[model samples]
Target: MDKQLSPVELRHQIRSGEFSDQTSGLCPGYTQANLVILPKADAYDFLLFAQRNPKPCPILEVTDLGSKNLHTFASDVDIASDFPKYRVFKNGELVAEPTDVNDIWRDDLVSFLIGCSFSFEASLITAGIEVRHITAGTNVPMYNTNIPTKAAGKFHGNYVVSMRPIPQNQVVKAVTITERLPQVHGTPIQIDHPETIGITDINHPDYGDAVEIKDGEVPVFWACGVTPQAAIMASKPEFVITHAPGHMLVTDVKDVDLSDIL
Candidate 1:
């Protein structure tokens, strides 16, 4: 697998079935997104839910019903085959994890691309912050917290968060750098206290790998794009689809393009 492929070329590989792997660290400077597809009947409620909670569900683009083309991301984008992997949900239970959504495509489905923290990982590495999971070649640790999202229609659930251990000295710098990328679930929602947020054992996470915390480092938590998946599971939506955890869509937009400070 070539790590330096451009977003266009990488997406092409995904579209052609030549590549099907987690997209983290693949397109280093490009933006990445989480995927969500739902029928038109549930579209308005989901859209309102996203708007009610922007930090965890920041909207990057929303395609029209019956269309998979995303105007702002790429002209040639194909939602069904663009991501390396997709998860299918029926009544909020995962029934299939496929490489593409070709067989399950529906005309009334609307696709949404939500901001992902992978867009900010490059910046974190550039600032000398150690993204332990990346260095360890593992998925970032994610957990479900007790924090409740504001109710929107029938969608209401706890927030999901991704964790990274930052060196004590670099914690402030991590916050300063990430806060600017608000469009991508910015900053540490919790810097040191895990128990305060209902996460008891940091070692066992609800999703992804558990990375080591070095001697002087403290765990930092950030709102995650997977919050929607949690909501889906909690509310038992009739039908929904999402990108598998860590398997994101590499967008044509550069990470810096989404940041005002850059």
Candidate 2:
């Protein structure tokens, strides 16, 4: 698959079932979103939660109830089918993982497009930083932190973070590159000390596989899009849908466009 495809083209491939893989490197220069679809009844509070915790839940666009088309992010994009994978949760438990959720579409559903770390990851790679997980061909390591997000209604939970191991020398440069993309979880929330953030063992991540931390490298952590999912599970809404881990919704907006506008 060509990783250089435009976001619209990638979404088309996803919608048509031509592509159904992790969107990490696809649509290289475009913004990729973390999707969260919930019942209209729960939309207000969820929006509030995102607003209060922008770092971990930076929202890009919110679709109206029952409307899957995100006019602000992409034209003619079908939320139900554009993402490569979907995680169906019922009363807080993940029930099934599906490639398409057309069978479960509802008129009362509200979709939210949250900014993802992939956008900033692109910036880091372009700046010549080695993203450890990408080099090792593994998912980035994520952990549930002790840091509590500001509560909104019943939506509340500890923050979840993604970690990347960087050489001590490159830490400053990585921070410099990522700091410019505030919409995409800007900068490292914590660096070097995993235990301070409640992460006991560096090798045992709560989500994704752990990559080696070289002798001169330190673990750098960033607020993750997964934080909202952790919040959703804690809240235990009657029904909720989210993009599967690493399977994000590609958007028409470019990373440079997002950075420039900000």
Candidate 3:
């Protein structure tokens, strides 16, 4: 797929079964969202979970109960099918990795569109920082961390973070750029300390692919929206749907307007 496709165009491609790959480095300048869909019975708990854990779960849009439509982020969105990929979990175990969820749609489902670190990469690139995964043409490396999240109702788990190898000299610039976009996981949570966060093997991440930590580069970690999936795994929700790691929903909202909308 062309990296320059408009958000709606990309969604159309995804919806039509034409584009079913990770969304990183696509739709530059626009926002990409991490998805979480749960039954209405579990909506409030997840909502509370997100509120208690803002950094990893900054919410962009929450679809109305039972509705697949969105209001703030995109006009041509179908919560059931727009994302590049979807993971269905049953009792916390992954059951399927389908490109669309229309086959399993339920009226009682509630969708949460969480802010994604991918949304801020455009800024990082514009500032001359090399996003290693993008350069390597691979999914951003994400690791399960020892950093625990605040418990909210039945939703509770440790944080999941995405890693980027930032040049030592440009770490501050990368931080400064992302800090302005808190809705998209604002700043680095850990720098050059994977062991400090319970990650024994940075070379073998829990999600996505690991990239090289070059000579002058330090692995910078950012809170990731995949935190919910970790929570689902630990908390053992009966059923849940999520965008596969790195496979996100390209939203109509632009990264620049994120702060104002929130």
Candidate 4:
């Protein structure tokens, strides 16, 4: 469980069923992705959905229909098992949470690697800004907000966001640093205003653990990869697959070079 393990080595462990846990704190300097798999019938519309709602669905790579390999993320990535956990949705309801989807994967299945907030976390730390969830050893708190994303075809729903409590003074610095990584959810979408986004209770997050918001700290929200799942669920697509909350696909790309995909 070395946090510095290379992506290939870490992915091997995941494939072997040796590791099936949150990928957030691992491979700190590498880029991690949100997994989304859909059949070819739904792929085009979904891709259009992502393109319209780029912040929450910032796409890193989209695999061809029926293709099992994607070179954009890494040379040795297996969509079926590189992720520690996968959630299967049928008609929008999550039906199964599997460690690997090889048993059900089909040639018509298309996969997408969406940018995740974890990619910019290290930069925040280096900029003297604390990432609250990482400090608390828990997954970042996420919420489904009242904010709506632009609709594309059958894909239409509200945006989901991840929240991090920042000190009042360091908020601007945090924004400036994270804004540099546009491919991985750049900048705070809502700064210091939880109620503005319709989060009734910050302590009870819709996903992940809640961390304390210390004195003088304010809640900041960032566009999240979960936004797509929200749309998928609302649209009630016949079939869909995505990474379980908190778990993610580790990529061979380095964090410093994230802008290369931008």
Candidate 5:
């Protein structure tokens, strides 16, 4: 329950079953990650898909097949136990939502650490921009969009986007600030018009809870990390594992390091 714990300490808490809460605001200055675990047979295609669609699927680190450690991102980290929660998919269906995946770990599984928007949200808050979802105490609204991704091998799906309502005058400033962190899903993909991106109702979303857009505010969209989960479901892989939405893996890398990568 210590919000100021280092990424290593947070991971240790998760490993010891002491903390299993969503990792949204925890470890504030560190980078939080989306995780994807796939069998080696499908890894090459997934990696290529990520490479082709960097906006939604930025690669942070990829562990060797059968290895539980992601040495580049955190020292002595165990992929199976570091995250607060995990989702197990079988042939595209979610079979389990478990706190730990140790029992399900496989020798041929490859772990991919993906960049998450949580890293960028901190920057948005620092710039005096009001993140409506956070202010309203609700998960960010996410919608399936008409935006198409560049397919690689068996992976292909429409883009998934996260929404935030910004005032008309501040939209440009928001875009400029977020654009600097391209590793964490950059600027607004669509502004003011939800229908243009295939979102039928601004009050309803495909994932996460809806938040109110005030009288002078316009709903803005950003490419989301969940886009890959949609792609994996569409591709119907025989088996896959991903971190539960909003429940991310914290890494030792600072958000400033990600800015440096841009």
Candidate 6:
């Protein structure tokens, strides 16, 4: 787990099963992605869902039907194995959490690469703001909120958000920095008040680990890419695969270049 490894190197390590942990602070300066794989039958609906709800499920690159190779985001990409961890669902039930999905690969599966908050974390750190989870060596805390997403086909559910506690004085700076990268869920959706967004228990998250919120800091919430998983649970799609919460795909694209996506 050398933090200095290049994106390609880190991905290769993941592909080889040498790295099977969450991808948070790794591959700094480069972009990271959230993954969603579905049978061709469900692809169109999910696409529509993402299009309608861009903040949480920003589309970075979607692979061709039945193909796992990616060209827009990374060269030499193997979609099935590039991500650190994968969650497989069957009829909306989580059936497996595998390091690689090659064994269960299907010719009709489509891969959707969604923008991730980790992509913008480096910029936040550069702005002199601390990303608590990264510094604490844990995954960012995520919560299921009462915020409803714009329904699209069978994908309609509440928005899932990742929380990062920002210092009181620097909250606006964090917002200004992230607002520039809309592709990766830009800006804080809810600030300082978790209960307003249906998050009753800040200490216990539905996904990932919780971190301390210092006296001078406030909990900031950003739309998370994992919202689709909640949709799966709500709609019960027969088969779908996603990156395990906090686990992500490290892409070759740089964070500074993400504005071009807008």
For each candidate in turn, the TM-score is: 0.94, 0.94, 0.91, 0.94, 0.96, 0.92
164-231, model 6: which lDDT tens digit per residue? 99999999999999998899898889998899999999999999899999999999999997897688
- Cα lDDT of model 5 overall? 0.89
Determine which window of 10 residues in candidate 6 has minimal summed lDDT. 253-262
Candidate 3 collision pairs? none
Off by over 4 Å in 3: 2-4
Better by TM-score, candidate 2 or 1: 2
lDDT of each: 0.88, 0.89, 0.88, 0.87, 0.89, 0.89
CA RMSD per model (angstroms): 1.9, 1.5, 1.9, 1.6, 1.3, 1.9
Candidate 4 lDDT tens digits, 1-262: 7877899999999999999998867887888888889999989899999888888999899998787688777878788988899999888788999999999998889998898887788888888888888888888889989999999989898989999999999999988998898888888899976899889999999998899999999998999888887888888988888998778888888889878755
In candidate 2, what are the lDDT values of residues 59-153, reduced to their tens digit? 88899879978777789799999999999999989999999999999999999999988888778888888888888988889998999999999
Clashes of each: 0, 0, 0, 1, 0, 1
Task: Give the lDDT of residue 207 in candidate 1.
Answer: 92
Which scores better on lDDT, 1 or 5? 5
Candidate 4: where is the Cα deviation over 4 Å?
A: none
The TM-score that candidate 4 achieves is 0.94
Candidate 4 clashing pairs?
66-107
Give the TM-score (vs. native) of candidate 6: 0.92
The better-scoring model by TM-score among 1 and 3 is 1
CA shift at 183, candidate 2, in angstroms? 1.0
**Tens digit of lDDT per residue, candidate 1, span 1-262?**
8898989899899999999998877877888889989898888989999999888999898998889788887767899999999999999788999998978899999998899887678889888887899899888899999989987888889899999999999999999999889889887789989999999999999999999998999999999988976776788888899998778999888888875422
